[model samples]
Target: MDAIREWLAGHKREVIRFAVLFMFLAVCLFGLGRLISGNTAETDTESLQLDETYLAASSVESDQTPVQPQESGPAQEIIIVDIKGAVKNPGVYQAEADMRVIDIIDLAGGLSETADADTVNLSQRVTDQMVIYIPAVGEAAERPIAVPENNLTEQEIGNEEAGTEKVDINTADAVLLQTLNGIGGKKAALIIAYREENGSFQTIEEIMEVSGIGEKTFEGFKNLITVGAK
Candidate 1:
């Protein structure tokens, strides 16, 4: 024991130096762990986040609109006609198959102020080359048909129904028309036979072309008659 005490006393400086070196090593290792701690963990977390972001972007692209697939099929052609009077944007436009006049009006920007949509036959089917006439109100009012002095007697007809004649260009025969003061029996028959063989007349002036109608009689009946329209 005396000899061991002697040796420890002599080596006390060396022991103190060894202890100080060991403490310095421990401090360095702790500092190194603290400095590198945040960077490595952050790198691993960022890598994971980048992988998740890529996955999310991939999913988004699949759901969005893309070029549609083409189909092998026959295409169809469509014809459209325009309506101008009393309509908005009165111009040409594309039309769908099995379309109606009302739908075409909607595409032309809708009706204008003068458009009496009630008078228009919206239910009529649209035709490839049909023309629609939109007549103004009162434009089609019945005109006063002047009765010839001896033509139709007032005694036979009532006052309420007097002076109005709606001439049927298609069916008026010579005998019936001879009832008119200016048209003779022969002329009346000519009118009927001509109207019977042919289809309905397009214009009122066409009646003047019948064999016996002179310029004077045609002038007298000019405003009184209409063809194909009320």
Candidate 2:
């Protein structure tokens, strides 16, 4: 018993030293675990912040983008006209409403040097599908003198009552001639060409001399037309 007591007293200091070493190792392991947990929490917070920043940037881009506007439809209405004869260019042309004969003549490249401007009413308002004819110089003199609107003699009024108001073939413009039955732009042009080439018609039947007009066609409008004072 006395020997056992002496050995225990000598080893007590070594046991105490071993116990202190074990406690130090436990403290180090606990500190490392706490550090790992803190780092994981920080990493998650940084990832969430990055996601929020990306979302905010995307929202800003969406807001800053521009929207496009829509286009309108075509024009409402259009006026179409045919300009022929002594203009620089002769063909169909598009014109606006309220446009005058002079405006359209200009659009057709204006009158040629041979054009008899006085033969046409330049200030007349244009209409859709209207035909404008410009005569060459000296041609107007062959046309019957257009009776003044205000001073009509009794014979002239009697002439209007005698039949369908007879168109003076010698004086009629292409448009005025077209009012006759079966007369169109082509036939009207031929009539003017004949007049310009052959001088004024000596009789209404002379219209058949123009190409495309035959005896049958002339007979149809014969009573409705006159050659005026030959």
* Predicted model with the maximum TM-score: 2
Backbone clash tally (model 1): 3
Q: Write the per-residue lDDT of candidate 2 for residues 144-187, one digit (tens) a residue.
A: 12222222233322222243357899999887776554576778
TM-score of each: 0.31, 0.35
* Cα error of candidate 1 at position 137, Å: 3.1
- lDDT of candidate 1 over 103-206, digit per residue (tens): 77788777777766777777665543333334345444122122222233333232122354555666565433443435654666777777777766778888
Error of 1 at 151 (Å): 36
Model 2 segments beyond 4 Å from truth? Answer: 1-163
Give the top-scoring candidate (lDDT): 2
The per-model lDDT (C-alpha) reads 0.60, 0.72
What's the distance in Å from true for residue 65, model 2? 14
Worst 10 residues of 1 by lDDT: 141-150
Candidate 2 at 222: error in angstroms?
A: 1.2
Model 1 lDDT, full chain set: 0.60
